[model samples]
Every structure is written in C-alpha cells, then in structure tokens.
Target chain A: MSLFMDLNLPFTADKKRLKTLLETAAHLGFSTVAINYFHEGQSKGKKEIPKPTPLAQLVDELPIVQGKSRPIKVLNRLTILVSDASHFRHNAAEYRAYDILAVQPTTEKLFHAACMTFDVDIICITVTERLPFFFKRAPINGARERGVMFEVCYAAAIRDSTMRRYTLTNTLALVERNKGKNIIVSSGTDKPLELRGPYDITNLAQLFGMSEVEAKDGVSSNCRSVLLHAETRKTACGIIYTVKTPNDSQPKDGPPLAKKQKTSAS
Target chain B: MVRVKSRYLLCEIHVSDPSKLLLLEDRAITAAVKDAVTSAHGDYGAAQCSIGFSVKYVNAHTGILFLRCPKSSYRLIWSALPFITSVERKGRRISCFLSCLHVGGTIRTCQKFLIRYNTQQLHRMLPKCKTQEEKDQVRRAILSSSTYMLKGKEHKEERD
Candidate 1:
C-alpha cells in the first residue's frame, strides 16, 4: 500500500503546538506531512515572501509513524495567495527553499494562469467561503494535463457548519469539472485534534462526490504524485546531476554528458 | 421465513482527555452520530440511519462501543462516524473521535474479534511489565479470558 500523506499542515509560531501536531500526525499513520507557510499578496506595496522554518527547530526527535516503524517525514511548503496576475512571480529564487509550491488564486484569470503557466505543484480551491466564480472546464483540464493537483481542505469544515456547506459545494463543483481526477483532500489543520486518520479522510472524500477508488487515491496515490511533481520542479526536466566519489578511479571528461549528448544531436 | 440482516460496527472513542470518556453516554453517541449523518448526507442519510439503528453496547472504561444498523445503510453510518467530532453532555462538549476496529454481520463474530484483539494487546503489554509478578498476572489474565470465552460458548450450545 502507498504510504498516506497530508500535503498541508498550516504552520504555527508555537513550537510546542507544532510538536504536538507532528506527534499526532505520526500516531494517526501519516507517513509524510508538510508545514504550509501562507503568504497573501498585496496590491499596492511590496511584500516579502515568508521564509520556511527549519524542521529541526520544531521537534527534537521525530515520532515514529504508526504501523510504519520509521520516523515521519516532514516537508516545508509555501502557498502564495494570488489575487492579481502580478501577485505571483515566475521562477522566484525565494520559492526554491520550499519543498512544495502552491498558489491560491482568487480570480478566474489568475486561476487559469496558475493552471497553464505557473510552476506550482498544487492549486488550493477556496473552501471557507462561497466560490466567487464557477470552475470552468478549460482550466481544470489544463491543470490536469500539466500534472497540477487541486487541493480541498477539510479543516474549515470541521470548524463551522457554514464552512462545511461551502466546502462541499466547492468540492462538488471541482469534482464535476474534473470528473474526480487529479484531486487531493488534505487537512489544512492548525490543531492536533483536527487531524483524522487516512481511512477517515478517504471516507470523507467519498462524501465530496468521489468514487471509492478516486477517494482512496485522494489520500494516497494523488498525494504521492504531487510530491513527485514538486521534486521535478527542483531539477532540470526531472534530471539530476551527481558527482563521482573519490573512490572511483575514472578520469573526468572535458564536457558534461548532457551537453555532449545535445551537441551530438545538433 | 426470511431473516433480516444487520451490521455491527466495533468502534473505539479517543478523547483528548481520558477522564472525558466517562461523560459519554449511549444516547449522546447515537445523537452525535445521527447529527453527523444528517449534515454529511442530508435528510436521506439521516432517514436511512434512523431505521433499525442503535447503540448496542458502550464501555466507558475501555472506550469501546458497538453500533448496529441495517446492512444496507451501514455504509452511511460508517462514513458518518468520522464526522462526529464530539458528544455533548451537560451543556459542554467533550471533543473526541471514534476509530472503527471491525465490522461484522453477527455480534458473535464481533465478540470473537474483540477477544483476539484484546489478546494481542495484552501480549504487547507483557513486554512493558516491570516486575515478574505483573508479567505473571497478565499471562494469567490472558489464559483465563480465553478459557472463559470457550466455556461461555459451550454453555450457549448446550442451551440451544
């Protein structure tokens, strides 16, 4: 079975609370979790992107994941709230620090741009409030083609009944547009009590209009693909360069292998 | 004559505070579960869960409970179980969640599964016992529990 992962856990300044959240997540059987740092764009003035906190400072000893003897893996994620086209900077140097990049676009135009052109792993759908615009087919398909996953957060639903209605409504709309493909459900939770087990999240996904297989994928395989998508964003076309160890007696060549291949093709 | 079928759900409630488990009552759990089903699936789920649905057993000390519902609508209730964040008691809510351990068609099968689960838990606890007396006591408990279960089954067969 694929290891369960929660791709979004809202970052908090309180070290104690964050430690408890990580412990609870591991106890609940999530093998991987990401601490999400959110930055909302301003229209007028320049805003500095928030830096991710180092994982070592949060917890001294990582807790072992339940049923998996190994320790839980923690990742840093940055989510930029893009209200306007100018909000998101393309290939910003600051974004490389995060393991995953996500954007929450408030407008249809920004949403389309994020889907087709933005270098992001996940697009967070608005769940706490009424959706300002309808989800169109073009952007949804474009996102799927580009391997960008739509994220539906359930923590808001757990907090209030009104948010619950809005969450289900927006999720159903997204499911309709995408036919339940390339979507992931994550608990953007701030507290340890808000975290649910992976199977529970799967059941909750079914209530969001996904089939059994799709709901299972929402918590397991879909999240794995998103991690891979984020990894590829860090490399050149998903290719990595490795340095030979000193133990190897082979002499270095004049040109790199990739450049040599390109020159030969030309 | 045809017999009606039902599904038994064995669930364990996890509370942030262990003392809050005592505040959980059968009626409160049933109401919370029904409310969750209504909100999650609307009136259709509420209606489906209302029929032949009941809290069959509750053990506050162990935090284990059994829920019974019709075979067809059991999925509706099982899915709704996760949405039950807490049970309200005396104007205050005790925040908790239920983790389902097993689902069985017959209560007997559920009881058997619970026994096996408890035995496994005891074995796991055996290694943590600091004193030899404590270890011996746990071993005795495990053996007695199994024999008691077998004796009860034999008595039931004789009566039948």
Candidate 2:
C-alpha cells in the first residue's frame, strides 16, 4: 500500500510528551501525522486563533518511519469544535496557516452544514460521548461527493469503556449511512502508547463495519486524497499556490520583486 | 457429507514480563478476546463468538497459541484480537498484545506456515546483527540447523 498516515495527534503544551508521541507514531509506521489543535469556536469570535508551532520547533529531527527509510512528514491541522451555526467563520484567515482544516460539529444542524458545505478536509465525528443525533444520508452523501472525509479517533476508546461505546456507536451510525466511504481513522492521542499501528487500525475499522479493502484505504489512500484536497484548497487546483516565486522564474527575465509579492498576496 | 469448516489462528502473545506469560490460561485469553468483541461489536458478535470457539494449543515458553473458531466468524474474532489490550490473572495484569501470525483452514497449515515464517524472520534478522561476532554466530546457527535438517531427512528416507 501507499504511505500510511495518522492525521490527528492532539497538540499538547508539553514538548517532551509531544516529541514522544511523534516518535511513537513514526515507530508505528505512520509516514504522515498531523498535530491537531482543537479550538472550541463558542466564545465571541476571538480574533487571534492559536498558531501551530513549526515542526522544526516541535521536534529536533523527525524520526524515520518503522519500515520506510524516509523520515516522517508532520503537518499542522486545526479542528474547530463548532457547536453553533455561526461559530465557523467563513473564509477565516487563520485557517490558511494550517495544512489541514477540520470542523467537529457538535449539533445536528452544524453537522449537516459541516457535511454539506464546510470547506474542510475532515469532519470529526464525536467519539467522547454518544452522538447527539443520527447521521442522515443526504449530508453524508454531500460530504462524500465533496471529497470531505469523516474522522473517528480511537484513542478515546482505548482510554475509557464509556467513550469506547460512543466511538463504536457513532462509527456504526456513520458507516451504516455512508457505507465506509470517505472515512479516516486517526489516533487523537496525547500519550505515545495510545497510538496504534496502521494494520491495527485497519482491523479495528472492520469492527466499524468496513470491509478489508475500504478499511485499508481509510488509513492510506483516503488520507492521501484528503491531503491532496487540502493542497488544492490552499492553491488553485494544486497549482499556483502562490504566484510563482521569483526564483522559479528564469532569473534573467524574472518579474520584479514588488510585482511578484503583490501577485502572491492575492 | 457436509464438512464442518473452521479456521485456526496462529498467534503470538507479546508481553513485557516473560514470567506473566505463564499465567495466560486458555479461559482467560478466551474471556479477554470475547470481552473485546462484545465491547466493540456488541451482543451479535458475542453470540457469534460463543460458537465452536476453542483454544487448540498454548506454548508458554514461546507465547504462541492456536485458536480455532468457526470459519464464518473467524474475521469477527480475528478483528477483536487487536482490541485486547492485556490479559490478567490472580489480580496481576500482564500488558500484552495478540499478533495473528497466520490464519488457515486447518491447524496443520497454520503450523507449517508459522515454522516457515519464523525461519524467514531469522534470516531477515541475520543481516541486522550489530557485530561481526553476532553475524558469525547467526551464520553458524543457521548452518547447523540446515545440517541437522539434512540428517533428519536422510534418517527419514532410510526408515521409509
């Protein structure tokens, strides 16, 4: 299979713990991992969204994947816990900083909106508590059509049996409706031990109603597609992310710095 | 006559404490696996799990075991193995993981595959030795094993 990825690892203030978590993820053969910063968008719209630390600052050196010789790829992701319809700011500038943007809609109405229209790479399904509402077909279909994936974190399940019930219940509901399409399973973990291997997650996905192929895809190809979608979300169709940097142009005939910067600013 | 179909799972239990491996009884492993299945998949899985499930063998030294389950529900049981975080006995918990080495229609096939797979693993580890002494030791061990196998084969041929 292609590179396996765990797209969500909870961001913590403790650097050592985060480093160990990253090391554990790398050791488990996750080629790509995202440091997830959870933001509850409930208060009077805080202008300054928390910024993700650069990967260099987070860890001195990325560990090589267990089987792959290449070092792990780390990305930043912002997961907005959207409880109200107005909580999600449309075209928020803060979102541009993150490589992946996700929204965890707590209510059915917000969930429907997130599934149908949110310009997010992933929609986090609640695993900490029983789903507040049933997953409807229309919204899930919309999400599938738009290439937005739903995320189910398994760390909660390993921690508490109650959360495990909720994780299974919510996963089953989503699977029953979507039939295992566009689902990404991640370890929303802070500790190193909570992270599981890719094959382990695939087997666990079978418990979530996915067949072998779909479960395998959920961890590998589907996450790749999500990353691609995020790339496109940043750039215009994965090309022209920023007006061609001056160095990319033939230096002899390159555009002026001011003009290039202006074009990139747009 | 209809054949009664079943699947046998060859598994290795990975535990931090080797001493605790002695406490892993068939019943306790069964309970742990069943509890994981019930928690993950609920009553339907539990009902399916109770059918024709048996522990064929347990190797305490190697921490290997063969679990037999009805062919139809093998995946259900197999999937639940990853959820088994540990095994407990006498109020002492041994943190362990169940890794399925092979699954086959018969225990004989599983046993054959495990033997071959383990040999392959040994071969793979030979090159990863850090020192020349270790490399020489592994090479000598492999040569001795192969010679031993050749002698056994000759003896078997003579008997035949």
Candidate 3:
C-alpha cells in the first residue's frame, strides 16, 4: 500500500502550535509532511528568504503516524509566489536547504514558464480566488511530462464558504485540464484543526472531479512522485557520486575503488 | 418483498478538549452535518441528506456516533463529515473533527466493528499502565465489558 503524505503544512512561528499541527497530522495517518514557507517575490524592498527551523529545534520527539509503526517524516519546502518570470531565480543557493520547491504563478504567462522551464516540484493552483486564466493544455502537458505535480490545497475551503466555491471551481478547472494526472491534494494549513485525514482527503478529491482511484493516488502515490521529482531537482540528473581514493591513482587499485553509476530513475 | 437498504457510518469525534464532549448533542451534530453537506455538495447534497438520514447513535463518553443514510447518497454524507469543524451548543462552538472509521450496510455489523476497534485500543493502552493495580483495573474492565456483551448475545440467542 502507498503511504499517505500531506506535503504542505504552512510554517508557523509558534513552536507550541507547530507541534500541535505535527501531532494532529500524525494522528491523521500522514506518513510524511512538509513545512511550507511562503515567499512572495512580487513585493518590493528585497526581503530575505526565511530559513527553515532545524527539525530538532521544532519538536523534541516526532510523533508516530497512526497505524504506521514509524515516526512521521518532516521536510522543509519553499513556495515562491511568482508574479513575473524573473521572480523565480534559477537554481538559487537558498533553495538548496529546502527538501521541496514550489511556485505559485500569478499570471498565465508565468504559469506557462513555471510549467515548461522552472526546476520545481510543485505548481500550486490558486484556491483562494477564481483562476484568472485558463489552464492551457501545452504547459500542463509539459509539466506532466517533466514530472512536476500540480497541488490543490483544501485549507482555504475549510475556513470560508466563499473560498470553498473558488477552491472547487479552480480544482475542477485543473482536473479538467490535467485529467487527474500528476495532481496532489495537500493541506496548506497553519492550524492543527484544519488538517483532515488522508481518507477524508481522498473523498473530497472525488468532489473535486477525480475518479476514486485517482483521488486515492492524489494523497498517496502522486505525492510520492512529487517527492521523487524534488529529489531529482536537487541532484544532477540523479547521479551517484563515488569518492576516488588516492591509492587508485598509483595503479594499485582493485576495480578502480568505485565506479560512477548514473541512475536517472526520476 | 422490498427491503430498505441504508449505510451506517461509524465515526469518532475528536475534540481538543475532552470536557467539551458533554456539550455535544445529537441534534447539534445532525445540524452541523447538514450544514456541511449543504456547503460541500450544494443544494443537491442537501436534498440527498434530508432523505433517509438520521443519527442512529451518539455516545458522548466515548465520543463515538453512528449516522444512517440511504445507500445511494452515503458518499455525500461521508464526504461532508470532514468539513464539520465544530458542533454548536447554546451559541458556543465546541471545536472538533469527525473521523469516519467504517461504513457498514447494517448497524449490527457496525457494532461488531466498534467492539473490535475498542479491544484493539485497550491492547494499545495496556502497555502504558505503570502500576500493578492500574494494570489489573484495565484487565478487569476489559473482561467485564466483553463478558457482559457475551451474556447479552447469549440471552438474544435464547430468545430466538
């Protein structure tokens, strides 16, 4: 069985509240969760990107996921709100600290650019407002081919009824374009109460226009794929590095110590 | 003979404060569920929820409840259960969430599942007992509960 994962828990400053959020997520049977830090690049003043808190400083002992014998895995994610093409810096040093990178494109052109060229794991579909531009087929297909997953967060829908309409509308539009391929449903929530169980999310995904199997994959297998894609984005085409021993240069080597293996599984 | 088929949803209510569970009422949960269904599925879901829908059981002490709905529209109700964030009592909201544990065709099957679930929970809690008295208390509680259930089952069989 595929492990359930909720990849976008909004980063909160309060350690107590963050702990509760992590505990709640673990109780809901999420095997892995990512703490998402939002950075809006459109705003002026040259603000610095926020650094992720070390996992040790946040929680002393990680809560074990319910029904799963192991403790929950926490990862840091950076979501850059891209209004213009230049907003998303290509291969920035700051992004290396994060386990996953995502972009929320404000305009259609930026969306196209994000899908086709950006080296990111996730493209967040705007759920707070109506989608301004239609999701063009070319960019979506390109993203799918490149193994970039599209994310639809359900936190906004839980908070307000108006946003719920927008969430459903935008999610349906996305589903219509993507046909439920390479889509993930994550809870972009700051509060612990807003987190829903993985099965609950799967049921809700069906309401968002995904088939039952596709809905299940949205919370499980597809999220795993996104994690794998993020792994590839961090590496040089998923290359294996081998350390060259000094004695090997003296022609006293047995099988050259280690051979470099290139595995582009992602 | 045509028989009415319905789905029983076994759900556990998880609250941030356990004391607030006393404020929960069947009517409030039903209202909250109805409100969530209306918002989630719109007017169509509301119509489906109103027909053959009822809260079959509510155990405030255990924070468990059972909801019955027509088999055709149970998914609408099951889907809406997650959106219910609270149950309002006397204009005050008790923040909570409903986690659906199982969906059964009949209430009897749901009850059997609940018994098994509770036993599993008891096994998990057994290791946490620090003192011998506490461990004995848990063992006695488990034995008494299951024996009482068996006695009731035997009486029902005798009646048949």
Q: Please provide TM-scores computed only on chain A for all of the candidate models, following their numbering.
A: 0.89, 0.89, 0.89
Task: Sort every candidate by TM-score, greatest first.
Answer: 3, 1, 2
| Model 2, position A246: C-alpha lDDT score | 72
Best by TM-score: 3
**Clashing pairs for predicted structure model 2, backbone only:** none
- Measured on C-alpha atoms, candidate 3 has an lDDT of 0.89
| lDDT of each residue in A145-206, candidate 3, tens digit only | 99999999998988888998899999999999999989999999988888888888899899
Task: Give the CA lDDT, 0 to 100, for residue A262 in model 1.
Answer: 100
- Candidate 1 scores an iRMS of 2.1
lDDT of each: 0.89, 0.83, 0.89
- CAPRI grade, predicted model 3: acceptable
Model 1 stretches astray by more than 4 angstroms: A241-266, B108-160
Task: Report the Cα lDDT for residue A165, model 2.
Answer: 77
Q: In angstroms, how far off is A64's CA in candidate 2?
A: 4.1
* Evaluation by lDDT, superior candidate among 1 and 2: 1
State in Å the error of residue B52, model 3: 1.3
lDDT of 2 by residue, A139-198 (tens): 999999999999999888887678877888889989999999899999888876566777
Q: Write the per-residue lDDT of candidate 1 for residues B89-158, one digit (tens) a residue.
A: 8889999888777789999999988887777657656766999999999999899888978998899999
TM-score of 2: 0.75
> Mind sharing the TM-score for model 1?
0.83
